[model samples]
Target chain A: MFTLYEFASSGNCYKLRLAMAQLDIPFQRIEKDITRGETRSAEFLAINPNGRIPVLVTPDNRVLPESSAALWYLARDSKLMPEDPFQQAQVLQWMFFEQYNHEPNIATSRYWIHVLGEQEKYAEALAEKQQKGHDALAVMETHLSDRDFFVGRDYSIADIALYAYTHVAGQGGFSLDAYPAIRGWLERVERQPGYVAMEA
Target chain B: MFTLYEFASSGNCYKLRLAMAQLDIPFQRIEKDITRGETRSAEFLAINPNGRIPVLVTPDNRVLPESSAALWYLARDSKLMPEDPFQQAQVLQWMFFEQYNHEPNIATSRYWIHVLGEQEKYAEALAEKQQKGHDALAVMETHLSDRDFFVGRDYSIADIALYAYTHVAGQGGFSLDAYPAIRGWLERVERQPGYVAMEA
Candidate 1:
């Protein structure tokens, strides 16, 4: 059994949950409120010194931290991970983009404008955030326009990674009106077998 | 043939270079000056719409972005990527930790303090960076204390991902004296076949 320590609102945490559901891998969930700093507790720190959510405790007592890492673990050797070298690399390429470009812009903007409630204070930053966020989305919109999935023409961890935040990007104040391709792709991912909503 | 668009000082780019050298895979190198914003140019962005350096272009003109992703591509079906399901996840787990905890801290700190010398401007954020950077180093120090490599007791992409930035962490105004374990691991990575210096 895998025990997951997560925050329900976190896209990173959601990545793990969605992947586990896709694989039909049974796991336990322990929620942590990052805003209140529950992750800093001594007990939690012992498990993950980084004190972040979505830490997966394996059956063998090995604790794995990081959401994408957990997803990679759950989908390992499964259909979620591509068999070909180039296709596998394609999955990772998008994952990296999620972290470096997409997440930083879209996820950060969403956190600031919606969750933080300091939109005015962050207005200037938000403008840049939206632009960069859209830039990332635009790239995705173009790529997804012609493909059913991010790589290998099959659903993979890359979709799981990008889907987590993208589905709720509007909550972060990012309008998806222009990204019809990405929107369609999201529907495709949502329809995957064993799919689980973030709130679910 | 693989053509890598990279910057000499970037740890992310260095990871790909190091891996290629280790595998004795020859590839053409196209150095980009990130500081000059070469990555944002139309030509470069065409290769990688994300406008990021370390984009790997295959013979077929397919462009793959992200350093870790590029490493995955080069290592796919090779010995560098772990074969076992659990072990591969372990590798990814560490890689994700590097991005969220380690890279954001150590790598960002190095860039701000050493490369840009904007410590005063980032002073308010400096304390947080310092704390997080030190904390990330602590995790690496402890992990390396017990293992020769990040996963499976052999050099893999995990080591390659981490070694890229850590070896030059000192260049970012971080001291190596506090991390003897990491220093020792650095030596081990250096001694690996086809070890390439950061500036090389």
Candidate 2:
């Protein structure tokens, strides 16, 4: 059996849970409270020296961390991944955008504003973060304007990567009202086959 | 023919160029001056609404952007990508690390200290950037102490992503002396077949 070390509130951890659910793959889950520094413990450090959540340990004793990487691992040769070369790269393109443009802005804001509750200390960085965050959202809005899904008219890991955090972006102070296309796309992803809510 | 739009100094763009050279894939190169805001031009924005560099236009008129995505596009079904499902995900793990931990610290510092010439403005941020940058380097140091490459024993996209900026990290005011393993690994990558150097 696969074992996943996950954090309940982390989108990165949620990605693994969501993928496992969608694939109907059973796994033992060990929840680490990231807020309490549970991931930094010696035992957990042995699993992933990076001290991060969502470390997926395979049955063969291979440990794979990083949510996107875990998604690729679980979905390879399965219906979750695209067989076409170009289509697969498109999925990666969106995933990279999620990391570079999307996550840095949205995730940072979430950490500072919501997690740390340090609006005053991080006040200067907030404007830049908000601008970059909005820019990322704008790009996503444009791309989703004409698509039912991120790639090949199906829900792939790309959707999983982006959806993990985007659905909860409102908690980070981003308004969904301006991004109608993204909002619509979010609904479509929620209605996907075998879909499971983050906490459900 | 593959047409690549990139700037000389972008490590992300360098990843694609390095992969293309390794694959022996011939392509036309179009230089985009990211520093002067050329990526934001109306024409460039038409091809990539995100207006980012390292956009690859394939023969079928499909445009693939983002460095990691483009590398996968070029290496898909080739010997560059591992056929094993788990190993391929291992590659993605390092690639994601390159994005989240490595790029944010090392790449951002290089862009700021070396390219932007805004050291004073970035004083506090640079301090934090250096700490995080060194932390990431330590992670690579520990991983490389035992293995030749990041994923499998063979060279893959994982090396391409990290090596692009790492060799030139000194330009970002980072010291390689502390991480002997990473330093040695850089040499190993440099000695690889079809290895290419980023512009000095």
Candidate 3:
């Protein structure tokens, strides 16, 4: 069995859980509390020197960190990935957008405002993050305007990566009112086979 | 031939230029002036809705944006990628670390100080970035202290993704004096066959 080390409430970690469910991959999860700095513990650092969670330890004992990397590995030969090489790169394109442009802004804001109850403490910073998170949503909305998914005409890990945080963006103070296309895409993603919610 | 849209001074853009040179892939360069806001223009936005440079336009006219994705595309079947599945995911782990942790701090500080000459204007922000950037450098130092390359004992796109900004981290005011391992690894990346300077 695979062993997934994660923070249950973190969408980055949730990406692995959702992907595992959809792919029918069996894994045992070990929760790490980020609030208490468990991820930064010396023992945790040994597993990932950079000290982040959502790491996957395969049945063979190989360690893989980073939610995107873990998702890619799980989806590699499954129906979750694209067959075309160019489409595969497009998948990476959206995933990179999620990491670089989406998650940092959306997830960070949520962590501060919702998870840490620091809405007022980080008011100034939250305002800035809120604007950028909307920009990221706008990009996603425009992309999903003409297509059902982010990449070719199918559901892929790209959707899973972006959906992890986007579904709960209100926790970051982002409203989906302006992004009908993105909302529609989110529904389509939820309806995919064996799709699991983060709370699970 | 590939048509590479770039802001030449950006290491993110340089990742593509350097990768193309190493792969012996011929490409025409279309320089975009980011300072003048060219990337955000409607035409460029049509090319990449995210409005970022280092976008690759294939000979067949397929447009692929995001430097990491383009590098993965160009290196997919080449010696630049690892044949092992787990090792390939390790490449993504480091690349995500570059985008999320390293670039935002290191490259942003470089842009504020080295490129924009706004050192004093953004002094406070730069200081925080400097600390975080060093943290990123320290992680690279420890990782490289024992390994020759990022994954599977061979130089891969993970190196190119990281080497783009890391080798020039000094411009970001991050002194590598304490990171001899990182310096040595930089030299190793420089010696790879078909490697070309960023300016070319």
Candidate 4:
């Protein structure tokens, strides 16, 4: 069995859980709370020098960190990944967009507000992320305006990457009311086969 | 021929130029000045809703943005990309790391100080990024201490992704004197075949 180091409440970690469940890949998860500094423990740091969670240890004991990388690893030769080379790159396009543009703003805001209860402390940073977060959502809204998914009009890891944080953006004080296309896509993602709701 | 929209000096844009040069993929270039707000122009926004450079239009007219994604597209079936499944995921691991940890801290610092000439204006933010950039460099140092390349000990897109910002980190006030391993890796990258220097 594969071993997963994760914080249950984290969307990044949840991306792996959701994918493994969807792919029917079995793995045992060990919860490491980031807020409590569990991830900073020397043992945890040994697995990932980066000191982040959602690390996957392959059955052969090969360790991999970074949620998208782990997800890409799990999606290989599976339906979650595309066969077309261009579509595969398109999957990467949105995954990078999520990490660079979306997650930093959207996910961090949620971590500050909902997870850490530090909305007041991070108010200034939160304010700055607000506009950028919406810019990312607007990009998604426009893209999804015509297509059902981010690439090849199919639900792939790109969708999973974005959906991890987007579904709970309201927790970060982001109102998705104006993004009809994004809302529509979120609903479509929830209905995919073997889709498991993120555990609270 | 492909059409590359870029800001010539940007490491992100340079990634494509370098990759295409090494891979022997020819493309026409159009320079867009981010400092002058060229990327925010409507024409540019229509091409890339994210308002970023390093957008590539394939010969068939398919538009792909995000530097790593474009690199993956160009590296298809090439030596720059590994064929092994796990190694491919490892490549994605470092590329994502470049986008998240390295670029935001290191490259953004270079942009503000070196390109935009606003060191005084961004002093506080620059200070904050300094620690993070070094932290990223530290992680790289540890990883490269034993390995010549990032994945499979080969010059893949993973190295290209990090080298773009890292090689010129000095311009952003990052000192490589303490990082012997990283220095060695950078020199190794410079020695790769078909390498073309980024035009200033």
Candidate 5:
């Protein structure tokens, strides 16, 4: 069994829970409210000095943080991880793209506009984020136009990683109407077995 | 042999070169000058739609982008990667931290202040980047205070990934004087066999 410390609404945390569900791994969830300053508390800091949520405490009592890392751990030997060395690297490439290119823009915009409701205060940043978020979506749209999945023609954690914030991107003020391929790909992800939607 | 498309001065590109040296892997290098807009060319975009340097083309003609993912690929079967699953996840955790936390602040600051010399132009963002970069260093200091490396009691790709930008963080106006543990850890990394320095 694993113990996951997370924020229920966070896409980063949702990535882990959704991966575990797909992999059929049993884990306990401990919710931390970031908006209430819970993640910054001393107790949570002890679990992850970085003070981020979606940390996994393994059956052996080892603490693992970083949502994508947890996904890789849970799906390592499963069909979710590609076996070919190059394909494995490709999976990681998209995962990194999600963090570096996609999440910072899409997720941050969603946080400011939807969760925090501080869109006015964050107007300047949000404007820049929206442009970059669309750039990220365009890249995904181009890639998905020729493929069924991100790697190896199968639904892998790369899909899950990118899907987390992307599905809720509308709340961030991004329109999916311009991205036909990404829209089709999102539906393909939803149809995966044992899939769990991000909780409200 | 592998073919690497990179910018010689970028810490992100240096990461792959350094890792290959440490692992004794030989690869051909193709330099792309980002300042000259070489990465944005149609040819480069055909190789990686992301239009980023540090892309690796495998012998089998597979194109892989993203520095840390390429590091994982080259080091997966080597001593640079942990054999244990939990330790592997730990390695991935720090790699993710390097990408999501450390690199964005440290590397971007370096580019603005050192490479582009745009400190005044990016004054507002630079100020925030400096604070976040220091916070990232503090986390590394606290962690290194108790350990020699990021994971499994050995130097792994996690160290390589973080070390790429961190050793040069001073160029970004980040002082290393307060981070004695991180300074010592940097020296420890330099002492590893087959080590290579980031090019000027």
Candidate 6:
């Protein structure tokens, strides 16, 4: 009974869709085209003042924005979220890292290059983003080298949060060839039950 | 029983120190000077490959990084975090907004201008950051206009997360004259029990 306002191509939006699919939660999807100014409209602003997509309206009509918050809401008390307090904090640590470290560089670069098709105009910004994006991936690679998942040996929402942008990093001009551990981990996440791919 | 690796002036690191004080938790503080490259040392990198401070080593010697994650851990069972699932998500929503929308612009600009003293070299980036920082403040003003706090009726870590960078936004060249609601909210948070100010 949840209604999700999203932009399909956005990895932030995709994180919620993928999480719902894995949790077997039935929800309605309403596409908001940012390029066409759908998200900035007065009507959409009423739903989320932030004017961003991937907002989840609950069955009771409460509006929840922010994809990572939505993922934590949907997965809490489920196996996707750990029971241990420390483990839960660890999962949150990675989710915060995805938002703070990974998304700004990887997702923003992908939007500029792939969706907006303005790579030349954003050349300078993209260069800085590419370097930082690789640094984020390197951190993930090192973490994954000794662990199969970002948290406590399980496929949690932390995996979903990081996976959304990372799987499509090439769209942002990032190469995965050097990250063997990340590659293996990506495949492991894909093998999880009810896993859904990001739509084109 | 806890060891905190932090940078004294960083709002991100200060969030942890402030939270621990409000919660009445005792911990040892170890300051790592990022300007002096303390965070990038091989020894520091071993604890957090991300090479960032505000890392909390738990009583069991488990290392945890990321300021928001540390806030969640320290406040999980306390009144600082809500028990209701929906309220908890709302708290997290604001926390994410602080990290994604607020911090990057406000905190980064402050670092460049105040700490690094390189406003001239980062002029172009600072201009963009200033605009976005104002936008983020606008969003908070709208939200706070109708509520006493970010989530529910009580103060939570969401306020702490946002308050960290915002209280000193003037250092980043952002004026608070237009944000009356945010100004009032800041005072309310300062009046909270056990509240601690960021160290000089």
Question: TM-score of the A chain in candidate 6?
Answer: 0.98
Local accuracy of candidate 4 as per-residue lDDT tens digits, B1-200 = 99999998999999999999998898999999998999999999999999999899999999999999999889968999999988988999999999999999999999999999999999999999999999999999999999999999689999999999999999898999999999999999999999988776
RMSD of 4: 0.9
For model 2, residues A1-200, the per-residue Cα lDDT tens digits are: 99999977778778878888889999998889887899889998888888887899998889998888888889876787898888888988898899888888887787778777887888788777888889999998988888888888888999899998899888677888999999998998889878878762
Q: What is candidate 2's fraction of native contacts?
A: 0.95
- Of candidate 1 chain A, the 10-residue stretch with the lowest lDDT total is A109-118
Model 5 TM-score on chain A: 0.98
Which segments of model 1 are wrong by more than 4 Å?
Answer: A112-128, B59-61, B112-128
Best prediction by DockQ: 6
TM-scores, all candidates, are: 0.90, 0.96, 0.99, 0.99, 0.99, 0.99
Tens-place lDDT per residue, model 5, A80-165, is: 99888788888899999999999999999999999999999999999989888998999999999999999989999999999999
Screening candidate 3 with a backbone cut-off below 3 angstroms (N, C-alpha, C), the clashing residue pairs are none
Instruction: Decide which is better by DockQ, 3 or 6.
Output: 6
DockQ for every prediction shown? 0.71, 0.88, 0.91, 0.92, 0.89, 0.93
Evaluate model 1: give its TM-score: 0.90
Q: Which of the two candidates, 1 or 6, achieves a greater lDDT against the reference?
A: 6
- Candidate order by DockQ, decreasing, is 6, 4, 3, 5, 2, 1
Residues A1-200, candidate 6, lDDT per residue (tens digit)?
A: 99999998999998988888988899999999998999889999889999898899999999999999999999999989988999999999999999999999999999999999999999999998978999999999999999899999788999999999899999999999999999999999999999989986
- C-alpha lDDT values of all predictions: 0.83, 0.87, 0.91, 0.93, 0.92, 0.94
**Tens digit of lDDT per residue, candidate 3, span B47-109?**
999988889999999999999999999999888999988889999989989999999999999
**Local accuracy of candidate 4 as per-residue lDDT tens digits, A12-127:** 99899999899999999898989999988899889999988889999999999999999989997799999998899899999999999999999999999999999999999999
What range of 10 consecutive residues in model 5 chain A has the weakest lDDT sum? A79-88
User: lDDT by residue for model 5 over B103-125, one digit each (tens)?
Assistant: 99999988988888888998889
lDDT by residue (B47-68, candidate 2, tens digit) is: 9999988899997789998888
Model 2 bad stretches (over 4 Å): A116-121
